[model samples]
Each structure stands twice: as C-alpha cells, then as structure tokens.
Target: MQCDICQRSPSSRLPFNCTLCARNTLYQPRIQLAQSLLQKEALEKEVDQNVAGTPKPTRIIPAPGGKPSEPNPSWIVQRAAAEQIVSEEKTQGIHDHVKTLREEIQNTKAEIAARKARLQKRRSEFASAKQELSKSQTGAVENMDKSMRRTEHRWDILHNKTAESRLFLCREAALLYGLHQRKRKKGGLGRDVYFVGGVPIADLRDLNSMDSFDYGLRQADSSIDASPAHVTTSNTNLAHLVHLVSHYLSLRLPAEITLPHRDYPLPTILSPGSSYTGREVPFPGSTPSHSSNNSPSASRHADQRSLPRPRPLHLDKKLSALAKDDQVAYASFVEGIAFLAWDIAWLCKTQGLNVGGNSWEDVCAMGKNLWQLLLAPPPRPSVSREPSSKTPPQKPSLSRPSTAAARTLQPENPKDVPPLGHFSHGTAYGYLATASGTEYMRDWGLQHPLRVIEKVKAMLLAERTGAEWEILEGNEWEEEEAGSEAKKETKKDVVRPGIEETVILVRPGGVESGINEGSGGTEREESDGKGRGASGWMKLKSR
Candidate 1:
C-alpha cells in the first residue's frame, strides 16, 4: 500500500516506516507554517531596515494576529511611477540625441553638396584653361615656323642679289680692260690677259673664273696655303692689271676717280721718275735713295716731295693684301673698279663714241671698239699739191634771229634744243676725226700718256669735280627749263596794258573834266573820291 503523502512507498519500506510517517505527517504543516512565518518576519525586518532612518507617513505596521499584510498599494504605485519616469527620461534623451544626429547629418550633406559644386567649377575652369593653352602652343609653333621661313627667304634673296652684283662687277672689269682668254702654247691651258689696242698689258691666269677669284678672296683672309698657287697668281695679276688700267684711265679722264684713303698714304705701282713705267715702289714710309749732297732733313723733305702723288682710281696696296689688312679697303678697291669702268664709258660717250645699250656685253663691245680707236697708230701724212691760185667765192650769209628772239621762240619740246654749254658741231667733228685715225701725228701725240695727265689735271681742277658732273648739270638744265616753261605759261595768263580810254566827268555845276585811264579803271575808281558822287550819273562807252 501506498502512503497518502509519498504514494506507494509502505510495501518496500523498513519496519519503523509507518510510525515515522505518522510523526512526519503531524508536524509537517506546523513546520511549513513556522517556515512561512519566519520568511515573513525576515522580509519585514529587511523592509524595516531599508526604511530605518526615514519617516514613512504612508507605511502601517500590521498587528501580530492580523491577516498577513497585503502588498502596499502606495509603494507599488511609487515603484511603477519611478519606472515610468526613468523610461520617459530615457525616451526624451534618445529623442534629443536623434535630433542632434539629424542636424549633423543635414550639415554634412550641405557641405558635401557645396564641395561637389566647387569641384565641378574647378573641373570646367581647368578644361577651358587646357584648351586655351593648347591653342596658344599651336599658334606659337606656327609663328616660329613662319618666322624661320621668312628669314630663310630673305637670306636667299640677299644672297642672290649679292651674287648678281659681283657678277656685274666682274663683267664690267672684263669689258673695261679688254680681258680675254688665250690658250697657252705648251700646256693648252687658257691664260687670261688684258690689252689696250691689241698690245698686251698684263698676263692674268684664270681671271675669267669667278669661282677662282672668290676662292682666292676667301683664302686671302686665311693662310697662304689655303689657296692654290694658280689662284693666288691670278689674283695678283688681276690686282696689277687693275692698277695699270686705273692709272691709264685716270691720266686720260678729265675728272679724278675719288678713291678711298686720300688722307692715309700707301704703296703704289707708279715710279718716282718722269715716266710711269709701272714699277713697284717701296712703301710710302720707306726711303729708296739717299743723297750725299743734301742734309738729312732736306733730303727727307726732297724724298717726300719726290714721292708720286696717290692716284685717285688706284689702291694703295694689292687687293689680296688689302683683304687681309682692311676689309673696308678691300671693298673700296672693288668699288673703285666699278667707278673706273663707268669713267671709261662716260669718256667714250662724251667724245661721241658709239656706246651701245646698258647691257654689260654691249658696254664691253663698245669699250673694246673705243680702246682700239684710242690706241690705234697714227695714219701717215700724204703729199699734197701746191695751193690753188684762184680764191674761193664767199657764200651769202643767211639772216638769223637774235639770241633774245631765238630764246622767245624756243620749241615746246625742250629735247629739240641743245642745253647750254653743249659740245659744238666743230668739237664733235674734231673728236670724230681723232677717233677715226684721220688726225695728224702731232695732234695724236698731244694725247700721249704724260701730256694727257698734265692736261687732265688742270682741266679737272677747273671744270669737273666728279664723274657725275655731266649728269648733274643735265638734270639742273632740265629743272631750269621746266621753270622757264612754267614762267612762259604764267606770262600768257597775265593781262597786258592796252589803249587808254578817256572818261569825261560832268559836275553838278555843268563843268566837264577828262581823265585818261588804261585797263586799270578799277584802280582809278578806288583812288578818286569824287568818282562815286551820288548827284552825278556817269555813262561808259567802249572805243
């Protein structure tokens, strides 16, 4: 059998189980009650201890025999209230924290937007700047290329012009001096030589080759070994030939050549003797001879005096030496060659020689012709019969207008009339006769080198200052003619004095007075005060 409290434990229990069960059953309820009472007391004590120092107006102590104390409604309500307050405070603090977080997020978003806008603006500005920089770089490159091309073009043009000028100079020199190339007998190589009337003056090697001359010129600035021996020889020969030709032309030409270095003296090809034999003299500073009879000072003075005067168209030193020593002197020497050529052509033209066209070839041909004529041998004089006994009949002189009448009747075209101081027919014919080899030996002898030099020097001082005198004088004559023509035109427009007309004035008292006035009637009216009298009426009639 099962016990009431344990259920089915008595059969398997020990011998004293029943008595112990009865005892446990009786005191179990009391023990349980006592435990419950003790727990209540402990809880009360704990509660009292918790409120020991505080005065509690809402608390009530229960009687010992009263029903077990119920939970205090006030205390429960207080606890709930405290919990609600804590929850509400936490919710409010959370709301405030959420609001602060929201504000911070909005500020961050605005700052990000502003930064994006600034970045976009910067990107656009950078793109525009890059485009501008690219365009500027392209433009600068194109401009630099254009400048280089322009500079090259200009340099080419300048180089071409310089080459043409040099070629023209060489052509003119060849023409003036009658330079020609002749084949040598042994080597078959051509040698350049210049002649005056077929008489050879100087032998030049390879002068016709401008390249060789330029090479020599270039080499002259450097060492002597830089140039070939033939080129140097050619240059030396050309310089000597130029000296001879210049001296010969200077002696014949009326005006001086006006070369460079008139103040500073140099060496010359002219000798100190009476005749110019084309001997090379020492430098102008050196003394060639000493005289025992004279004192040192007097001898020095005599030697200085005896030194030949510097030639106008000539160089003081050789061209190669000039090139090495002074560039200006070298350039002047080249210019002097051109001047000498021009002088020769001008002389031929002045003497009525036929100078052809402006081309260098034509000028060369003309120069050659003129040189032949000038250097030709005199024609032998032929025997003539005695003078005729009968006198030649005089021709009737034609009546001509006076100088003033001729000037008044000058032609409208000024070219039809000769300028003042123009060469006369007789002088032109005399030059023609001399050039045609018809002049007497004695007359031709007057044109000898020595005599011509003296005569030309005197005539140059008196008449000519430069080679362009004739050209300047012609231009001046043209200007004067133009002025004279203008004066003639103005004179035609002028009114001349004519027959006088007599005016008779009648006064108010019937007295009559006569006045003689020419074409200046307006002047008489302005001069006389009574001419405009209001009381008198005047009548005018033409006669």
Candidate 2:
C-alpha cells in the first residue's frame, strides 16, 4: 500500500494509508483546539482580575427639599477630561481653517500688486509714445511747409526766366526782320505795336503769343495785292522778312503754292530764280483789260469753284496719319507761307539786291538762344536729305568780308552762299547737347514755333471744315465735328473740275437729282459709277 502524503509504502495495517501520517493528521486538530481553549480561558481570567481591582461607583439619595448632592469626583474628572479633548480638537480645526484663509488672502494681494505694476508700466509706455508721436507730427508738418515754399520759389524763378527769354527773342527777331515799333492808341489806351512793312503784325505785350503773329501773317497774305505803288514796296519788305524767317527756321512748305491770279491756267508755283509778272488771261467772253469787278458774279463763282485743292509737298508719317480733308487744309496753310518766301527770293534776284550776306554764321552765333527758340529741330536720320556716306558732311566756310563795300557785294560763286540748314546748326547744338533737349526737340521742336504752326493749322482747318477748334490736354487742339456735316454738304454742292464732278440726272418726269444721295454717294460714284439710270446726265455748273 502507498501513503498519499509521503508517497511511500505503508508499514501499518490500514488500507492504502501510512499509519504514522494518519496518526499525526488526527492529533493536529485536537492539539489546535486545546491551545485555543487555553488562550480564551487566560483572556477571561485577566478581564475578571481587572474587574476585581476596579472600585464600583456609589449612588446617593437627596432629601425632598434639600439641594441636589454633588456629583462623584471620579465621574466629574472623566467628564471634564472628555470635554477638554473635544475642545482641543475643535481649536486645532479652527486654527487650520484660519491659516488656509490667510494664505489665500495673501496670494490674492500678491496677484493684485503684480497686475497693478504691469498696468503702470503700460501707462508710462503709452505716455512716452504719445509724446514721441506729437514730436514726429510737428517735424513732418514743418518739412512739408518747407518743401512747398521751395517749390513756389522755384516756380516763380522759372516764370521770370521764361518771360525774359521770350522778350529777348521777340526783340531780336523784330530787329533782324526790319519790323518797326510804333505807339498806337486804341480804345482810349496807348500800346506799343509792331509793324511789318506798315502792316500791324503784333502788339508789344503779345509778341510772345504765337496766335497773334499767325493772325497777322494771315492778314498780310490777304492784303498782298491790295495796291500797286504804295503796297508794292510794303509787300516787297514783307516778303523779304518772311523769306528770312522761313529760311532760318527751316519751316517745311508744300511743293507748290497757288497764288490768286486772273490767268486761266494760273501760275501754280513761282520758281526759285524766276520773276512773276501779273498777267490777265483772255477768255472767250472776257477781254485782257477787263477787271475782275467788271465780270459777272456767276462767272467769278464758276472760276473759283473749278479750282482744285493743292496736293501736299511730302507725306511724312505724321501727314500720312491724318484724314484726307485735314491733309488738304495743312497743305494750303503751308503753301501760302511758302509762296511769300519764294516770291521774295525771286524778287531779290530781279531787283539785283545784295541781301544774300555771308554773315549767317555770325548772325546765328549772336542770336544763338533766339534761333534755338525759333528754328525747328532737324529731321530724323531716316528722313535726312544728306547723302549716305561713311564720311561726315563738312561745315561750310563762312566768309568774313573785310570792307563795307565787300560785305555789300554778292558772292561770285553760288557755292559760297551758305546753305539754309547751316543757319539752324546753332539751334541743333542746343538740342543735341543733352538727353532731355533731344527728347523735347524730337517731339515738339522749339516751343514758340510749334505753337505758331499749331495756331495756323487750327485756323486753316476751321476755315476749310467749319469746325470749332477746341484746346485739349497737353495743349493739343481737336476739331469738333458738330457743324462739319453741314459744311460738307455745302462743299458737295459746289463741284470742282478735275477733282470731284457731281452728275445730275434728268428723268422723263422733269425730276433732276444727283446720281446718288447722302455722304456715301461720292464714294459710290467714284468707286464704280454703277447704279446710274439711263436718263440724260446734266452737269451742275456753279452759279
């Protein structure tokens, strides 16, 4: 048999169990029970001994009417001790709560003090910043005032300089061109007036104004053939003046100039060396001695209406950009000026005048600034008339005449005469010296001359198109097309030969009207001459 606890064969007579292990297990519970019983009895004996050693409390009775007897001393002492213990516990809790509240109050005061310090620092910073802002604002205002004052002073100086320069140029130009100054009374006021060959050209105060000069030129051109004896000499002088101005300024003119004449095939242009003698053309019905006033108004109107508009001399980029009507107006204005210049040059040769002096270089040098103000800028390299070559063009040698007689004598050779562009070289130097001058010259040329050209252009355009001229930004002029249509209608009614001929058709019903109607009629008639009825065509002669 095997023992379960020891895993050994049992030597006892029990079934499948060791006799020594069984005896130990059975006696272990009994030994533990006996030790517990002994411990419980010992505890009980100690409690009984404690009870026996303690004295019992005695009870007392009081008489009915007697006061309550005093309490037992031991009971009083125990109750007093319990009350003292509770009082100590309450005092400790109160002290703890008071300490905690005091700590919280101290922490709150610290936080408030820190916040106040931060606020004070922010206030001081704000005040300093405000003072700095005030100082900076005052300084900026003072600077602005100083700059404005400086600008005003500069503007005043520039205005004075411009006025002085204009006066000098006008005086020099008048002296050189033989303009005489006179005091004229008008409207109960006396003013200095400049006269070119007895014709009032401009007032002294308006010498700087280009419009004044252009208006004067137009008046002089209209009065060219007014009289014969007195006006001839005056016109000769005027022509000399116009020639000098045009030559020195290098003003561009049309290729031909049409002068008002009685000749049938009128003198289209006056050649450089040719002399012009006024001649009368004998028509089929008119005699050579018949004056224009003796002719019928209908014949005069027909003659005037038949004349064609002159073509432009050259179509540069600027002229090419303009409308057809504008180009005609421009050509007419330039050609009129060219005629005055060309006529004088022709007359100078016929009269045997020694006016072609070789003192052009001296004159240019003496009035350098004046020439710069009057002469137009040189043409661009692309448009320059100079021949293309690697070598530069040589400057003409100026002849210094020794005696007064020699100075009065004309040059023997034509090559000795200075070229027209040489007179403008001094003006060109002024422009070519600086970038700003180059740009200004390229765009507008000299200021006064440009203004004169613009004024003449506007006047010619107004005369031709009946458009009101209006000044725009940058001193540019624009023509208003408000009354242009009416003017164009009037122009269409008057047919010019070899330019535009309006055809009128007479139907069987006696109705006569133009071949086409409206503005597009001219274009249609010129393009294909289509859509015309088979009626008889009648040309409307100007009355």
Residue-level lDDT for 234 in candidate 2: 32
Model 2: lDDT of residue 44: 55
Report the poorest 10 consecutive residues by lDDT, candidate 2. 360-369
User: Which parts of model 2 are misplaced by more than 4 Å?
Assistant: 1-94, 121-125, 163-543
Count of clashing residue pairs in every prediction? 1, 0
Q: For every candidate structure, what is the RMSD over all alpha carbons to the true structure, in angstroms?
A: 37.0, 26.6
Per-residue C-alpha lDDT of model 1 across residues 315-398, encoded as one tens digit per residue: 455444455577664444333333334344434343233232222322322223233223220121211222122221121111
lDDT of 1: 0.38
Instruction: List lDDT for all candidates, in order.
Output: 0.38, 0.37
Q: Which 10 consecutive positions of candidate 1 have the poorest summed lDDT?
A: 463-472
Top model by TM-score, which number?
A: 2
